[model samples]
Target: MTISMNCKRFAILLIAVATLGCGNQNDIGPTGRVNGVLTNKGVILSPHTQVVFLHSQGGTAAYGGTDEKGNFAIDSFNDGNIPIGAYRVMIQPPESQLGAEDEPSAEELLENSNGRKAQKKDAEFAFKYRQLSTSGLEFEVKEGENVFQIDLK
Candidate 1:
């Protein structure tokens, strides 16, 4: 009889603890945050790449580059800045490269007149979730902090 009572007491305690623990599981994050690293296949992208967050209502937000560790944070726009809808994220190098690179100097690369920068003016790149393009990727922003890992390939 005593053993049965102890087991019942233990079960009640377990139930109470479990109920308390799960009481706020849905309240993890009120305003969502997006944090992720960008990669293509297995290769991580260069820091010079730009990440653009496009809103459903036709506007864009920009983020520069990730840290040396490849971690990025979009904590500011967590409160549905882009609205609760579809969006296309885009990443582009300073300029599109036509062929293999031989490590040009930073100064030359920075100049808009250098190499293929002028020719790339009409080059199109932006991927949509429904259709397809090279410059963009599609993502649906959910409520709360969302860690979205992007694969550009």
Candidate 2:
């Protein structure tokens, strides 16, 4: 009986050790803050343009939005830092006034008055850099602060 009890305790301790070693460590990987300006033909992009940093290895993407001055900061995993890796950059132009005008008003949305409507028009620059596969823009995120000036022409 004594030997059996000792074996059971040893097994439990071994299992605990193994479980502790298998913890998720990806969240603890090295990361860095990224901020930059985006310009098109030497002019700053419009405010509220969406920017995305897609990891080259396939994982959760980092995202940001440009201000009126075309400044942005990349964020990932709910934090304002991106994991160190190579990333493909994608930029989505701000929604056009025509698209905004086509959207149902708050009252209509709340009352479900508007049925399905015509698709809104895409922005002039929507398809230009909105796709990571076609953006042709790439950058590397390191273990410290990263600043860049991206020009689209």
Candidate 3:
């Protein structure tokens, strides 16, 4: 009789702790803080690469790059947290390599004008996650801080 009472009490306590969030899980509010590390296989990708989270519902995209240690956080264009929903992730070279929009360095311009080719540095990632449809990486953002350890092929 005592054993059964203890088990029942434990179960009730577990359920009470599980549902201690601010409100209903379904109501995730406006946004969710999204951050993670980009990894290839088991190794972290620390190169100058950008991660893009395209909203599954086609609203906006949250994008950011990893630091030297390979950690990244994504923010929308409005400088706010990512909207709560599913998103398709894409990894690519940073904005500096997009060309035209980013101005070249003075030395690079001089080298170009003098017919001397400027040395080009490429991002270290070799896998094909540069496109939304090809990456095959998806994540759902819930309310509060969402940490993802995204591992790629």
Best by lDDT: 2
- Which residue pairs in candidate 2 have backbone atoms (N, alpha carbon, C) closer than 3 angstroms, thus clashing? none
**Model 2 agreement with the true structure over 32-141: per-residue lDDT tens digits:** 88899988877887787777888788565878888989899987764787778888998876655334554556666566645643333543353447678878989988
Q: After superposition, how far is residue 28 of candidate 2 from its true place, in Å?
A: 4.4
Looking at model 3, the pairs that clash are: none
* Superposed Cα deviation of residue 12, candidate 2 (Å): 3.2
Please report the TM-score between candidate 3 and the true structure.
Answer: 0.59
Residue 20, candidate 2: C-alpha displacement in angstroms: 2.5
Candidate 3 has its poorest 10 consecutive residues by lDDT at 118-127
Worst 10 residues of 2 by lDDT: 117-126
CA lDDT of 136 in candidate 2? Answer: 90
Candidate 3 lDDT, tens digit per residue, 1-153? 999999999999889888785566444258888888888777777556788898898566878888877798887655557678999989976656556423346778686877644444453454357778778889988877999987777
Q: Which scores better on lDDT, 1 or 2?
A: 2
The count of residue-pair clashes in candidate 3 stands at: 0
Task: State model 3's lDDT.
Answer: 0.75
Best by TM-score: 2
> What is the TM-score (0 to 1) of candidate 1?
0.47
TM-scores for every predicted model? 0.47, 0.67, 0.59
lDDT of 1 by residue, 16-124 (tens): 9987785663342323446688776646655545556665554535344565555666533433233444566766553443233423456656785646432323322
* Per-residue lDDT value at 117 in model 2: 35
